[model samples]
Target: MANMDISLKEMMAIDGAIGAAVVDYNSGMSLGVLGGSKDLDLQIAGAGNTEVVKAKLRTMDSLGLKDAIEDILITLSGQYHIIRPITGRGGKGLFLYLALDRGRANLAMARHHLRAIEDKLEI
Candidate 1:
């Protein structure tokens, strides 16, 4: 399995990937981060997205839906943000976050790449 560094590097190789992070939603902290610019501080984004994940989980619980979340997509005028909760044993309570330039990204391909990365990520 790929280590966190390798996983983050692989994520950056995705087309239009602007930033990527492995975050602990339990603590709202990033375990690893890469590719973020001044315009997109990944640390802040990781923490903010933790709330997004938590809120969604709460909503799912309230609705009594037993299904697990595969991912959450947030689209903006210029970007697409993907939050994928890590379900692996070593990665419980964490997630992979990616930000992409909407015009340059292929959403389907990006999602596929993220799934592959998630499968191989060691932590």
Candidate 2:
């Protein structure tokens, strides 16, 4: 099984990966981060995305749907942001955030790869 460091490294190996982080949505903090530049601060992004996750969960509750979020995809002009919540027992309240260059990223493959990494991650 992989740990946070290994998971973050694997994430960066993705074709268009710009940055990656393991964040705790409950506290809006990053447990681990990698590959971010000054222009793309993973810490700030992680905190901000915590609100996004909370809002979605609130929406789901209001809709009376007992469902879990698979992931949230935000497509910008030049980038694609993926926020995938960790569903493993030991990973509750945490998520994996990835930023990819839209021009270089294959969205399907990135998602697939993230899922694989999640499966092997040991928190």
TM-score on alpha carbons, each prediction: 0.98, 0.98
Tens digits of per-residue lDDT, candidate 2, 1-123, equal: 999999999999999999999999999999999999888999999999999999999999999989999999999999999999999869999999999999999999999999999999998
- List candidate 1 stretches off by more than 4 Å: none
Pairs with steric clashes in candidate 2: none
lDDT of each: 0.96, 0.97
What does candidate 1 score on TM?
A: 0.98
- Model 1 lDDT tens row, 23-115: 999999999999999999999999999999999999999999999999999999999999999988798999999999999999999999999
lDDT of 2 at 11: 100
Clashing pairs in 1: none
